[model samples]
Target: MNAHDRHPMTVPSEKRTAISSLWLWLGGALLVLGIFFRVYNLDYKVFWIDEANTVLRSLGYVSQDVTDTLLTGELFQAEDLQAFQQPSPDRGWDDTMTALRSSAEHTPLYFLLSRLWVQTVGSSIATWRMPAVFFSLLLLPAVFWWGWELFGSKLSAGLATVLVALSPLHVLYAQEARPYSLLALMTALSSATLLWTLRSPTWNRWLLYGFTIVVGLYSQLLFTLVAIAHALYILASELTIYKRFTPNLLRYLIVSLGCIVAFSPWLVLLVNNLAEVQRKTASLGDDRYSIGGLIDRWFRVLNQMLIDRELAGWNFLLLLLAIAALVYLWRQAPRHATWMLLLVGGVPFLALALPDLVLGGERSLRVRYLFPTVLALQLTLGYWFAATIPTKRIPQSIVQTILILFIGLQILSNTVNAQRLVWWNKSRPASTYFEPVSALVNTLPNPLILTESKVSDLLALSYWLRPDITLQAIPDVVTLEIPQGYDPIYLHNGTPETEATLQQQGIRLTPIYPVNDSVDPWLWQLEFPL
Candidate 1:
């Protein structure tokens, strides 16, 4: 072979420098784009049912308070429902604590922070969501720290930051008023601290890890899955290294026990109110999906971490890419690194997914529950990109192209989500119907909405409705009264019993909105016998 053919062409040092600088600039730009998306149009989407519940809880009002105030068979305006959502002089920090205790399904840390936040800033819709946005912003740095600690490479850290910054799922939760963004922040921070402690094993490092464990548990009940993953990682690591129990393992156990001791009060509360917690979350066990449906949802949620658009072919391609990334991580990364990521991601997912697959439930269908899995996947992809993109091989060009396309798709998906009033992640079953139904109701003159629906439904609908529109909420159809002088009286979320009661009164109900779907009909106009 000729000398030129034998020796492959190499890019000059200046060209390599330029490429690195370009990648750095791109990372910065993606970070800015993410920040902008997080805060942009914060109040644009439907302040969904769960968000309404969040506002009420933060304002120190429980379900009973809502029942007492709004569902008293009284004639009220739409603005009346908003009173519970606002901060008042009467409801203080103590009241918030009381409300949180009553509703033991949620942990108090996020609500307490939100109470302080809305009290400091005015309780506007955008302001209510600001804390989540702030936490999500912090998540970028936490993810960077995690990547740096795990791989000890700035390129990996930067790539991970870029991935998290452009993640559509993160952007969706960040703009929400709920605690999922805080959960994501805690997950990233805890993961990073665990890695740091593993490397150093100092007393302070162990204490820091313990602190994260406490904070994470307080953030959400699902964080227990994260703690389980961390414990498994430490146990597996020590067993692999030392072949038995050692000082490092013992220290980790002590720290873990300390974390549990610190969190015991809340744990006691949860155990005491276990029935209430179970009652509240019973909907999670509802067998809504078949095994095939669950698998479909699994893929969709997995794809949603990066892109939300339902290009079926593209989604499957991304799923394959994720599998390929995991395989690459297993082969190229250290065994411990692969094990840590797998346990962190796989354990939590399998915990939920296995139940759904074996017992037939939709517990694993929740997008918020998969936060750690999303982070692990992102880190894997980030590591793969960082390891490959700097090389001079043909695969380096392919990897670079894939990275650009992936980020570009994320931006496009996020842009689409930003413009709409609803997206896939806003998956509260009844909340999605609020926007369109409200639009229909708003067009009508002198509309009175009579709801026997849940108190949360009333509050959620109020946010979309005009203040002048009348809302009469009764406990049941037994006391249902047809108010005078309303052009058209509508029933929100009409039930069979409601229809039967109206029929007995010789009033036929006409389905207005959601004509195609009979299930959970949104609006029904009362047709009285003339």
Candidate 2:
């Protein structure tokens, strides 16, 4: 009967429409920006030491392999490593797998995917790194989906997507020939999948949850830790009477069984190589970490994620402010606090911390291990931005604008450096760093390199400086001989033992041209007294 009753909420509804449209465009722009960032100079790096492993052992995509043979080193026959120590495209699939299991110590999913990809496209540096870029893109929508689930607001989810897109740490891994980006992506999906199972323990959801865990494990060994995080969430949810425990509990057990069955093949191999695996992983965390060291490591990784470099000057100040805001968020949104912490932060923290306290290696120093933790932080910040009631005094528009501006600043920090836009920090891409080496080689008239085959990645060397140089291996450093007529003799990451033996053999080498981040220092001409 009243005029006010006819379309009473029209104005407010229009305002909501406008805000939603603005955020949708803004988030879409950010996603586009991320894609552009990843594609910028995508092929700017040759395979470096770690990447060489991916090419040679993981995928067999390269023309040759530069990895070394296994320690029981003398099995140089049919099952001897085809790509081991010296990678030639001539090696077979079995040989590559044999070398991977015996030495590389990685799962075959990424590598197998890589194998199929390169077969179709023809392997090149760009082709090799394309998978990382693909996964990096997949993670974008995944970030938005998870963020939306956490905050139930497009603004929050969009903000988180922009941050994940512009993350320097993630960007670095995205441009490499490695599985870290996949690990980060899988971690998010697996976590979400498990949460979905708990929320609705249907047959389909349980199957998906189990399947995601299997893929996550195949992606990265560290992903198994996420299982612990899921269990913790389930226990906490049950303790708080959030979910009942009958069929869901049984489904959870079945899910666990499914994951174990799926991962059984890799488990068998892992058990066989348990000693080698232990020896290799033992170097990750050390028992000697002081409280100061732990804090420093945590802070440094945060800086790396946002800045694409270390914290300093105004950037450091911004990071501090961000930390304050995140702390505020933790207080305001405790709904998922326990789950987020246990899933993304606490389990990882304890896993690394316990190893450092009990084991003797420095495992937690590597920032890559904390990718999931950073994801959780980003989600928390997203939720804090989306809240309708907690900070009602502050206008939502201003809050959204401020958070968006802060994320923009982070993007600027990473993109300001042309190199960091593609990888990490001011450190040049592998291609850029090796450019000088190639330029140097071009100037040299017929170069011969004498290197210890195992230590030097000749595949990388050949990749950059090919055809003009001949690489010779020195089986015994004691019989060191730089043959006459090789003109300039370069030692590739020569060992102390080799240098001493050369001196004992009365061979003097001039350290004429030395390269940074190279397999070895070159010995050209001869050493001259200052």
Candidate 3:
């Protein structure tokens, strides 16, 4: 018999090669699916409050309807406001940067890119979401490489790519014209480099890491947590290896100093606007971050990862899996399982939770804040399924089954999120941004639309609606004078509060009546005797 036939090495080698090819093919297929989902229904959801901010900020157009704060006269030029009869033209680059620096949160990286993007693509709703879609698609391959570097398993890397591609929350952010996708991509890149750097701290890698941190901070302030997480991981690892201070220990210290020097501009800006940051945080979510609150939020994020729903009882299962994965990594690959595990999976979450718990901030409750850590957790799970259990000599089919279950859950979660966005009335998942008033705008003659919202909100709507009808948010109706030959209509935002507030202010109306109007942007319309 021939040597090849006697040993049967050729057939087994062929089988292994075939399996590897299949894994690669599967990964490619999943990447395509993820890109399709990103592009699908790009202009589906209406510009909610947050999305409206993105549009206005991108346009650099100050709305005539600036929110009337009680202290506006003291702190801002409410009277000197720049109101545009038409959607304001693009403010020059410098002005755009200046406006964003003062008015909107975060540094101007994403918004600046978005402005230039809209200038080229045209600022239609569908076109606006394209940048985020690109970022989301970009993340698939990025995550694959990052996971590969950490776990050293082609299967784990491919699976991590698949998981990120199908992640419902990531998909939702990907469809929006927001900075989270950009931030996610940056952090993922930083994470991949950080993992490589941990293995061997070289000068080129340190410079790249510092550069990424600068870009990430420019993208979003939350990225600082990622930097801190890396620092802690390096410290812990060095302590374990050397157990005392040495020249090698100074390597990370130098990286920190480099970041400090590079990020000085944003650091100064951050300090100057601390109060504004606090206000924005308070506006974002509940500010309680106690031990109990942290536990609740941890589970909430895990829930978002696993089920993408708000229902309870799934937290325990998630916690158990996390423990099992950690224990397995600790036992099987202590070198990799120590620093990478803590940096990627532990520190970012704790960074947010600890600060919020002590300082009582608003970010702890938000899922987006923990994005870096969330990805780490996902990566760890991928390693667990691909390496840990299989390393223990478990049946390959069981491991494959676990992988299938995870993918299935992710797909189902995407389906659930899709249905919610498509059908939810509050979200108004429609093509045109002005769908809320589409029927009313063309039908009503010379209609003066009144809202209790800020001028910015009305300006955003005006951006979508034609400049034929007038939109205003007058807080005080008593001083309001009705223009001659115009029908006055008040769109109620889910309550008779507008009418009640009018009565409370002793503003006698010319038969201010509420009609169940389905065509108007608001459900309740108060027709007044003007």
Cα-based TM-score, every candidate: 0.94, 0.83, 0.81
Residue 135 accuracy (lDDT) in model 1:
97
Candidate 2: tens digits of C-alpha lDDT, residues 1-530: 10011111122566667767776897678778778878777776455656656777644343223323332222122122223323346766776577567643577778767766776787677888899989988998888776655544566667678788877677777878888889889877877666555555789988898888889888888787777787667666665553556666677788888889998988899998899887866656434667676656656666775555554544555566556557656555445543554467667756876666565445565667777777877776665555531245567777767676667766775476435322432133433435555567557777666655443245554556645455566666654444557556666556778777676666676664453346445433333123
Model 1, residue pairs in steric clash = none
> On a 0 to 1 TM-score scale, where does candidate 2 land against the true structure?
0.83
Give the Cα lDDT of each candidate: 0.84, 0.63, 0.63
lDDT per residue, candidate 1, 1-530, as tens digits? 00011111234677667866887898898899999999999989888888888989888898788788767888888888888888889988888888899888789899899888888878888998999999999999999998877776677778889989989999999999888998899999998888877776788999999999999999998899999998888888788677998888889989999999999999999999999889988888878677778878878787777677777756788888898888878876766667778998998899999988877778887878889999999999998877767675437768889988898889998898899887766664677788778888888889888887887778888898888888887576876666799978988877788788888999888887778674656788888899
Candidate 3 backbone collisions, by pair: 65-455, 65-456, 66-455, 510-529
176, model 1: CA deviation in Å? 0.3
Candidate 3 on 378-452: residue-level lDDT in tens? Answer: 777766776633343667787677677777777776666664433221244222335545455547766655555
| Off by more than 4 A, model 3 | 1-18, 62-90, 198-201, 244-248, 284-298, 309-315, 355-362, 388-398, 419-443, 463-467, 492-498, 504-523, 527-530
| Candidate 1 TM-score versus the reference | 0.94
Q: Report the Cα RMSD per candidate.
A: 5.1, 6.5, 7.1
1 against 2, candidate with superior lDDT = 1
